[model samples]
Target: MKTRQFFASLAAASILLAVPAFAADSAQAFVDKAAIGGKFEVDSSQIALGKVQDQSIKDFAQMMIRDHGAANAKLATVAGEQKLKVPSALDAQHQGDLDKLKNAQAPIDPAYVDMQRKAHADAVKLFETYASGGDNAGLKTFAQQTVDTLKTHQQMIEKIAAGQDAITGATTPAVKTDNTPNAAALVPGANSFTEAQAKSRIEGAGYTNVSKLTKDDQGIWRGHATKAGEGLAVGLDYQGNVVAASK
Candidate 1:
């Protein structure tokens, strides 16, 4: 009976010793799967950003490659010790993004900033979801760590898009000359036409048949009107509240 109890005790000790190996193997398997997924994701981004013309995007892509690639290598070492396998390629959605970015290599429109912003936004969402919901503890931890990085990237990309919009919106047409005075060169002084000066000058002028108005290359205000039988050009001095009459 003593021998029988001794045998059972040894069996339990063996099982306890084996438990750690099993756990280690399971942890490695989970980490391996995650690394595989991350590898493809990083590869897609590297190729996509490589085609971008923006220096910022290109620099960021280089960073992603270095960081994620290092993490993948580390994971491979861990997985190998536990006899686990990592996936060798990306999924369909990532492939699609890669293709789109590649095709946009030519010209590389500034509007591509919008595409980058959206992509980062989606990535943040995906990483956050997986980090919280993944079955493996190691994978979940890795994902959680990755989520912070992805969210930061999303914010940066959004700022880039906003900058592009501001640049586009602030653009104004170049001023063109049409016998109009170069009003842009005029310095505002005591004799300059203020809002009140302009309003008073136009109101008091006995101008008739005024069809078009413009400034001249010499900082003179010119107006066109049908006078008598032909178009006559007249200059007005809003600063003096008077018309210089056609000269």
Candidate 2:
């Protein structure tokens, strides 16, 4: 009788220990999702390295390639130790995102920024969930260590998208300041902002309906924008100064 009761209790304990193994995000699920997300970062950034014109976006793409490439390798190593499979390519959904980058609707910079925003948000959530409640000890540790890097990336991209994009925490204004009384005098220098970035900068300065943006010789982006229910000419300098256009 005593032996039977002991065996019963032991079985119950074993069952309790096995419950976490069937967690919502299983070990292999983490491996798959992480692999897919990492692949997307590497592949999309690879495309950006070749096609993107924005210097900030270009620098970010380079970082994604270097960082995600290393993370992928480390994940593969960990997955191998756990006898899990690492996917070599992006999943169907991520492949679609990559396709958009490959053949974007023009001004691929915005597309890339949009894609990274979504991707890093997903990655940060995934890593946070797994870090705290994952089935595998190794993956949980990896997720914990990686979550901070992903969050930093998220902040960086937000700054870039917001047009406050100098990695060094500063942007130079164009030689031509916007809102000068003489629209023709808007000085141009070297405008590196894509249309999307220029629009974002203008919008960030509280303008709306920015349209017909064109870069002139002084590296100034001149466009029609509305402020306070007033339609006026707006311009952005290389340094990101947005001012009303002289009528």
Candidate 3:
């Protein structure tokens, strides 16, 4: 009688364990969703960065590539370990998001840091939901850990996007100094200027002996200037903006 009771209790315990396992099958769904999200992030990041002209936006793109790619790898390893089957591609919802992102309509400006911030926000929310609600113990733990990381990334994106926004509204107008020469020959759409024309413009602006003009890689022209310790180069753009005045 004692042996039969022991065996019955053991069987009940085994059944209890099996119940959670069945529930954990739902983890496969979250895993698939994460994989799809990660892929869309990486793809959209690279493609949008290509169209972006802002330096800050370019830096954000690099971060997305690094963070999202790492997350995908970790998820892939976990999927392999658990024998979870992930989708080869995103599902309808994720695919729709990807299409919107590719078209720059989802984030409103694919190259902008705000776009990345919003995307990361969405990703963080998704991760949080799954991590907290996932059925599988392993995936639940993984999701919890990912939520922390995603929150950190979300903060970074927010900070950067905020900085970018500040830059938009906070540009200081260039102060015209007596020493700054007017060289209207380097603006993007400016007409060609001969050495004589450039020298005339420079000399007319209280500059002396503004000769020996050289062109930089971006087709901007520069003249030589002697500062405190050494001879410096003064790069002037087509609109005569002083791009760089350094040695």
Provide the overall lDDT of each model, using Cα atoms, as 2-decimal numbers: 0.53, 0.78, 0.61
List the candidate 2 regions with Cα displacement exceeding 4 Å.
1-25, 164-241, 244-247
In candidate 2 the C-alpha lDDT for residue 40 amounts to 94
By TM-score, the better pick of 1 and 2 is: 2
TM-score against truth, every candidate: 0.47, 0.65, 0.54
Model 1, span 91-200: residue lDDT tens: 57655666675766453535345555665666666567757775445555666777787677677666545434433432221233354433342333333333333332
Off by over 4 Å in 1: 1-41, 48-50, 74-84, 109-115, 170-247
Model 3 Cα lDDT, one tens digit per residue, 86-186: 66786786567657656664323324455466667777887888777777767777788878877887876675554344333222222235455333323
Compare the candidates by TM-score and give the number of the best one.
Answer: 2
lDDT of 3 at 154: 81
Name the best candidate (by lDDT).
2
In the predicted model 3, the residue pairs found to clash are 186-237, 186-238, 187-237, 187-238, 187-239
TM-score attained by model 3: 0.54
**Which of candidates 1 and 2 is the stronger one according to lDDT?**
2
Q: How well is each residue in 1-247 modelled by candidate 2, as lDDT tens digits?
A: 9999999999999999888666534888999999999999999999998877666778899999999999999999998988888988788899998998888754477789889999999999999999988878888898988899999999988867666433112222222344553333234678777889788766655677989998887788888877777677777766555657433
Worst 10 residues of 3 by lDDT: 166-175
